[model samples]
Target: MLTLAHALLPRIHHLAVPLLSGCSNDLSSRRAATGPSNFSIFNRRPTAENRSRLQALLSEERYLALDSYQTFGSNKKNKEQEATKHTKDIKLQDGSGTNSCQEQNSCLENQLETYEWQLKILHAVLTASGEQEREQLLKDHSGDICTLIHSISDKVKTEVRTDLNELHEKHLKSISEQYQSEAEELRRIHREETAALNEVFASSEKTLKEEIEGLTSELKLFKELKRRVEESTLKRDLQRNIETHGSPGEFWEQEQESLLFVIEMKRQHLQEQRSKLLQMQSMQNEDFKVRMENYQSLIQQLSREQNELQEALEQQALQKQKLSQEKEELLFKLLQQRTDSCSSFQLPPVLHTHLSPS
Candidate 1:
């Protein structure tokens, strides 16, 4: 559009200058002539052929200007579409370009009107019977024509600047909207990811909780079975001792005390293990796998200790059985010696009763 304005500027200057010069010359010639009023060298009317030629030129110029305006309008439309599609890369268009186009369009129309008026005034001046009418017509239109031409360039520049500023603002607004949309999309995606992570954590937590419960139940069952086995073994040992001694002896009492101590120790160990399990259960912040591993290790340690305790108890029972056998042999020897020494003497009933083996 700017190029178009620049091109039209020179054309307007060339066309206006020659026509204005010829008008001035004709008016001067009319002023100088003293012949009857109208008949003079410069006052001659233009021929029909000249009038036809001028009309054809004016029509062609008007047609060219209209064609250019239409072409510019189409191009502006295409460029606007492209701008909308690729907002980030869009060039700043002059905001007042449309107004400039309209104004220039009006200016061109005014120029054509002035030209037509000038042509009419020229014809009338040549054909006028007197000088007064010619002078009045020139006086009425000359200033207006000059003023329009002089202001055209300034108006075009101002409107172009205005148009550019407007385009720039529009471009900035588009970019802002684009940024806002992207931000919203990012926020939405973040929310979705957060939700997904929460879901996964929840699922894992639930699974871990279930697994812990299952392990706890298994541990309780194992401890119960272990307790029953130990109790049965102790009962069997006690029964064997009872059958051998025919009564509970000091050895049996000592064995029972040792067994009670071991049971107390085992109970204390179980209580400690239970406390550890409770502590582990309370530590929800720790990782599930780590806590699980700790629980497994603790259970294994308890099992190892239980096996050692069982082995110790078996060794103690074996030693007690050997001592009981020696004690029985000594009692039999003492009984035989007493009976020999008192063969003609009567023994005390309490002593004899005590010396008799059960």
Candidate 2:
């Protein structure tokens, strides 16, 4: 950056030195460049009439940079107001709970971008002006012209780099702090949610285990009853066999089938609960992904807006340059016409003197 300043300073001095040392010659060169008529006007300006006209032209000449600066100032003010309003709106939204802090952060980021752009525009406008216009502006605005010039030189030497560094530092710090807070909040929420989920899962598992234990105890009781009944039946059957030679086994087979059906139902209930838990986890992950996508889209939108603004500034500069050139041409034509009219009036005088007999 210092190297850039050093490089520009020589060019600035070159431009300024010519204007300071030989303004008339510079004006003559400019007139000569415009057209033959302007060059004639410049030559004719030594006469009293032409001198007065030249003085009038000099007095009435409006520097293009003056208007450009006024326009820049008005636009800058309006933009600043708009940025302030935007910030206020963000604050209001935040206070009302209508938008999150992230939105406020984004708004601030946009404001910073706008400020940076405005600064660049200001720098361009200042540096783009002709040396004469700059000199006039400085003379009009400052009491100590030399001091002001030196100050400007010093500022040009370091200000651009300093300002850029400050802006970057500010932006980086804000972004870092914002992300840090967000990350901390996310970590806290994650911990809370994880703990809650763990508690819920533990409770569910405990309930399932209690239920399984109860079912196991019930199955054990049924088995014990079946064993006792089988023992009694065996004794009775044996007695019956002893009394009336017979056998019984169909009842025992029916009891075993009923116990198998109860076990299958318990297994099906456990599988259904596991599937529900898996579905809930999947839904949570999808929600997180959607949120991430939204954030990325918002960042892209901000970048696009910044790009558009930069392009607009560049177009405006181009248009301003074209307008300035057109204005200069018009001024030259007007001066040429005035000089022609003055010369025409002098023609009749010379004709009268020639026509008179001496």
Cα deviation in Å at residue 107, candidate 2?
A: 55
Name every residue pair that clashes in candidate 1.
Answer: 94-163, 94-164, 95-163, 95-164, 96-163
What TM-score do all the candidates reach, one by one?
0.37, 0.29
For model 2, what is the error of residue 92's alpha carbon versus the real structure, in angstroms, after optimal superposition? 80
Name the lDDT of candidate 2: 0.48
lDDT of 1 by residue, 250-358 (tens): 6578778987998898789879978877786666556655655765675566556556655655565565556656755775686566445323223232222222222
Question: How well is each residue in 123-148 modelled by candidate 2, as lDDT tens digits?
Answer: 22233335565444433433333332
Q: What's the true lDDT of residue 50 in model 2? A: 34
Winning candidate number (TM-score):
1
Give me the runs in candidate 2 sitting further than 4 Å from their true place: 1-152, 155-160, 240-358
User: What RMSD does each model have against the real structure?
Assistant: 50.8, 25.2
TM-score of 1: 0.37
Angstrom error at residue 309, model 2: 22
